[model samples]
Target: MFRRKTTEEVPAQTEPRPERPGSKGRPTPTRKEAEAAARERAKLAQDPKAMRKKQREMRVESSRQVRQALKSGDEKYLPARDQGPVRRFIRDFVDSRLGFTELLAPMLLLIIILGTGVLGENMRLFSSTLWIVTIILVILDIGWLRFRVRREVRARFPEESLKGVVWYAVMRAVNMRFLRLPKPQRKIGEALPERYR
Candidate 1:
């Protein structure tokens, strides 16, 4: 007897369908559900206290990173003043020399002590002479440093801007070797590397 199969008579397929390669493998969220999720996110974003805390935390983390960069000479996190290849070259140039200005601080302190008459009245004239000599030496050294830095920078970075670079080198030269930010990469009297990019 050729009869049509009844609903109850048909066998159910138990095997799972194979998934397509690009399928998400889950049901898409309904519009209402998606809207609710977006609203929750917006609410969190709009919370003033939470936003302030997050911003403050971010600023602290950024400052900490910059400080670490300054100490370690990590170029990526260095502050704007210390950034760029030209500044780096200037730093290297300055650090390689033993400048007289580095001693200026101690010389000034000695001058101050002598001026205070703590040592003796007789020492005052000697202190004045020492102060005058220190000033002259510092001025000469700085002038030389500026001239040399300008010449080298011009030769090495012909296309780079020289603005503020001479001053930058002078300032770095004035600081004690151990106190310089972005700590010296080259030793005193060490020859600078040919390329600095």
Candidate 2:
């Protein structure tokens, strides 16, 4: 029955640990140092000249990459007109043939010169007729190219859209072989492999 009640004393609030000098741990930066770093960061971010220079450098690098991609026939970097296996097949198909479309530019120049009376009046009629014939021939050749490309694309890649592909092929055909991008993987008159058909 003689149980005694013990009283406990509470500890007072402790002070923060003092920072050790010359320790191997990272030293806390002073306020001025932090402000200086912040100012440097802000200067870099806000400088218009620097931003513009960076953008220009990026654009040049991008242009270089795109040009290389086009030269190498890299599908990832190709434009929408040249993308896809179907378009590649169409390019190969058109490139492999000796298309009349290849003469289009020269024929146009001939027509222009002839129509301008570079040839005498007596030959004017001949020039006019020649122009009409050339136009007809170009149309016919384009139609034939479209037809052949369509038939082959249908046989090879039925799911792809024919929208831009025909125009792409026509454009490629009209361009001189040496100037065409992704330069002519096959020689003129080379037959497409049977598998592509």
Candidate 3:
């Protein structure tokens, strides 16, 4: 009976939704759909009229690079020893020169996480526990796979530099989903052109 305060209604607190359009989007594509969109943009850049103008451009020379790279060795592109450090770094960074199947999905997950935060909201990419858990799983999976691959490399080439951890934290992203028509080639990170860089 001596209590001075009575029960008061309390207002529920809500999370503030981050503003958008007002803010520029992160530079890289965060999802497969985004990457597809980027591919279409690339096609348009290569040909403003798209297919109409695309018919005029010659691709015979472009495929030559792929052939030359393939013919060069068991590994695509020139050997790292022969290439400039910059080129070699780019090659190793992009193509998952470390391991293929194991790294594919993990790299994709990483790119999405980083891409989401490119604009402003530091928490934009991971506003919830779900995203955080997904990222953690990706890291664990990649770490586990890399450890296994490195073990094999060590066993096979014990005397040589058998350790090439291809894990990169950067937003380096690139994809060419040619089969998905009207999609631009999506490339992120250091590979980004100087203007975008």
Among these predictions, the greatest lDDT belongs to 1
As for candidate 2, its clashing pairs are: none
Worst 10-residue lDDT window for candidate 2 reads 16-25
Error of 1 at 159 (Å): 0.6
TM-score for each of the candidates = 0.78, 0.70, 0.30
Clashing pairs in 1: none
Clashing pairs in 3: 38-184, 39-183, 39-184, 39-185, 40-183, 40-184
Off by over 4 Å in 1: 1-44
lDDT of 3: 0.45
The weakest ten consecutive residues by lDDT in model 3 span: 176-185
Candidate maximizing TM-score: 1
Every candidate's CA RMSD? 13.3, 18.3, 26.7
lDDT of 2 by residue, 1-197 (tens): 69876687677769755646546546679999999978866786899898678778889988887788788887667766677677778878988998778888888788778778767875677778988888888899999998988888887787767777788899899998889986677878888876542
Task: State the C-alpha lDDT per candidate.
Answer: 0.91, 0.81, 0.45
**lDDT, ranked from best to worst:** 1, 2, 3
Models ranked on TM-score: 1, 2, 3
lDDT of 3 by residue, 128-176 (tens): 5545565676566556555654554455445545334333212222232
lDDT of 3 at 10: 82
